[model samples]
Target: MLVLGIVLFALGLMFSIAWHELGHFLAARRFGVRVPEFMVGFGPTIFSRQRGETSFGIKAVPLGGYIRMIGMIPPAPGQRIGRSRRSGPFQGLIDDVRADSVKDFRPGDEDRQFWTRKPWQRIVVMFAGPFMNLILAAVLFLIVLVGFGIPTAQPVVQSVSKCVVPASQATTTTDCPPGAPPTPAAQAGFQAGDRIVSFDGRSYDSWEDMQLAIRASSGTVPVVVERPEPNGAARTLTLYPQLIETQLLDLDAARTSGEPRYVSGSFLGLSPIQPVTRQTPEQVAGYVGEMAQRAVTSILALPSKVPALFGAVFLGEQRDVNGPVSVVGVSVLGGEVLASNNAVASEIATMLQLLAAVNVSLFLLNLLPILPLDGGHILPALWEGAKKRIARLRGRPDPGPVDMAKLMPIAYGFAIVIMLYGGLVILADIVNPIKLNL
Candidate 1:
């Protein structure tokens, strides 16, 4: 059953990718751009056909799909224009789309080529996939919002992360959240949703401090808290401390930076407060973005953030080399997420949003002022634009295109690095397949 669920989820994700590409195809065709071929895989065509002006087909691999717009990839000096591929709908149009960017490009035409379109239009074409993704995400969120509205939980502060709390609380905070800090011998006296402000005689700004104070209690001691009652009224509750184990980090391992180590012992009973349901898109986006940004920033800042980077050279953190997740990871996550949704619309919407985010990021990243990337190409264009005026003043011919070839090495290097990292991730997955935990 679990395996079936995983398969179902994977299929759903593939559909989403197909839909994202379709968005671009549909738009390009609508704009009269010539679309040559639209395919659902990367390698050579296993099944194909030319229908009307477009050729369509499915490939042996189901992992990815693409719509080949004539002139999408810059035609080398002499390639033909307005070409397309269209096959069949035997398995149904798993992927179909709006427009062909080549519609504007005719044989021996440059000014009307995609490259000739206003930069804004070019950007739009490049960005549309991701744009659709964001929209899809919003729609999914809407469904989730209207269906099973997120519920709110008691605002009791019981758990704190090891990074958030003082070393002393390390022993107890686990129970404060989902993990058990301690049971019978030191069961949590507080409830799951209890709001603990000041425990024992110590005033703590964090659960860490609170935990330390409690562990330090060592015996029955009175604790006070401001908690919300079942009727929505606020009240005070007092509890006594029970004996519990504590958490402590090893100085040597902690110094490694690469290997953060912590030791925790049982604590008096303590479970975390309940988590509330998400209520708004703003709330979801804010929280999600915050988490994503922080995670990204933390990884990037790890070297500076860790004092013993020099000593930790041999020890590496969770091989986050892929800078978090590779495409495989995203697809896996998406598969798991979209699989359970009975509603195809909601699933598609969610999947589209994910796709949008990916494409938008791709487009933006490509536009960065660097060589070999579209950004690199654009940078030269910018410089050439300015240089044209200077050349006109100096009565010199305009230096067109500014030799983009120079960036080839840089682009190749970047591509290799990405490929290597991706290979490593793929290897890891093959050696130890990741389970869909959802």
Candidate 2:
């Protein structure tokens, strides 16, 4: 099962990379830019085929993919292709990049180059890749939320505690201790599988609202519950149980920090049953929004996590559960999920969610305004557009396309850093991988 899960995830990753490149290919073609190659993965070609003007192929490595568009870096202003008069330490690098950008140039293809397209068209071509990832993530999220459903706490009681255990004394055991007072739910004859109907004369639909009402009640309240009979019918029961204030953990504080903060509140001993509940489209949208926010936060915090990743890789340190993960790590997690003893539906849902998260991460990470990234291309296109607009407004000649060759040095440096970070993450993933609780 583990091997199967890993294979499945790897295949999904390849498909995702292909889909992303397809976005760029389609958009580039839409704007009449010449795309010579549409390939998934990096390294030497494993399989390739020429289709019309494009050569489609798979590569040796399955980590990333790309589409080669003509004139990605425009020639120097008023200069011939592959010619540079500038002399500097980075000049050779810039010239090499410029030379490669048009190495496959053919006759009468000047207008078909990517740099010849309007700024908005270039932006569309660049942004289309990441946009495909966003679309795939949303679709996956919808399938998981609407088809399989999400685990939600229902209003039905799963268990009823015999005694009221204060937050301070509640460490592990939930069994009744000596001299502990009986809980309000126990006194009111609450049982497992009973569905809460109303609390204090007001009807309740969700467990959360009923919990808030239970916490706010001061005196004896009319608690109504529908308990199932042995004959398969449910009978309504109303019982008046005096509410007592007790020490309880402050939920907000506990959620913010993994520390217990106790406060006096009305105590109820019922534990709600968790069941899979299908979500509406609005709820799914909200869930996806929250996930996207977390992905952004994770991307922003990547720098701070490098030290921990380094330690985990070289110093034999324990891996942080919430730390960064590489492709290897994600695959291992998928394996673990499948190998677990969870229900089949649960395992499938978890796998879908994991893939969805991967897509979301890809969508956001590629949008960073750094060279070689989709956003890097997008930023230059936007600047070129702005420059053209300003030149027109000032009655001056067009400033022309942004000099992408000059930015190659910075892009090279960023690429090196990315390689190092990716290497560290991959090493850590192999050595000290995060494991699922299941």
Candidate 3:
């Protein structure tokens, strides 16, 4: 099952890559840009077949993919066909870049070249790929949040803690020390499966409301719960649960840390039941919006996590679960999700969430305004548009397209850095993979 899940995930990734490239391919064709090839993955071609003006194929490496559009970069001014000259050290590299940019030149393709299109059209062609990823992410998020339902914290108790541990020494293990005090929940005879109905004469439907009430209480509070009897009758139980000052899990700061930060709060040792509940369309949209914000924030914080990533790999420190991951790591997680003892529904929901996350990452990663990315290409188009507008305003001749070949050095450097980062992440993933407790 795990192997099957990994294979399925790999296939999904391939589909995503192909879908992204297809967006660019279609948009380029729409804008009259001649596309020579539409390939998924990179490196040496595994198999290829020419259809019409385009060659379609997969490649040896599945790291990334692209569609080869004719004349992505504009030629140097005063440059002619079949001309080859190297001015200086870096000039040869620039010349090679500009030359290869138009190597697919056909007789009639001169006018259909990408650089010949309007700035808006070029922008649309470059933006289409990332837009496809965003669309996929939104669709998947809706499926998981509305169709399968989202896992929600309910006012039902799943378990009661056995003892109260000091905030400074708190751990996940429930093994109590000798002579440790009993938790308020245990002392009040709070058992598993009890549904919290009210606290301090206040009725609450959600666990969050009940939790706040507990945290704000400084003394014993009137607690009303609906407990199910073995005979199937529901009986009301009222116990003054003396709220104790103990360590509470800081939910906001606990995401990236292995050990949750403990803060003093009125502790009720009952764990809320996480029930899968469907959300409305508006609710799902809000959820996706929040996720998109978080995704953007994570991408921005990625560079800062490099040191931690290295420390975790070389210094034997625990790796943060929210740290960067390569495709290998994601595939391993998919396998782990399938191999877990969770129900089929739970597993499917988890995998769907994972896929949505992958799509979101894809969208954000490609949107980085650096060379070789979709956003990178969009930048030049925008600049050209601005330049043309300014030219018209000054009543001068319109300038040609931005010479993207000039940015090749920086693009090459950025590409190398990205490759190195990916290599490090892949190595870290293999050495210290995140173990998810389902």
On lDDT, the leading prediction is: 2
Which residue segments of model 2 deviate by more than 4 Å?
A: 160-190, 198-204, 208-226, 229-271
Off by over 4 Å in 3: 81-89, 166-172, 209-220, 230-262
Superior candidate under lDDT, 2 versus 3: 2
For all candidates in order, the CA lDDT equals: 0.49, 0.86, 0.82
Q: What's the C-alpha lDDT at position 53 in model 2? A: 96
Q: Model 2 lDDT vs. the true structure?
A: 0.86
Q: Give the per-residue Cα lDDT of candidate 1 at 396.
A: 97
Q: Candidate 2, residues 86-139: lDDT per residue as tens digits?
A: 899999999999999999899978999999999999999999999999999999
lDDT of 3 by residue, 167-194 (tens): 6767767699888778878888888888
Candidate 3: residue pairs that collide: none
TM-score of candidate 1 against the unseen true structure? 0.57
RMSD of 3: 3.2
Tens-place lDDT per residue, model 1, 195-217, is: 65555555565455555555566
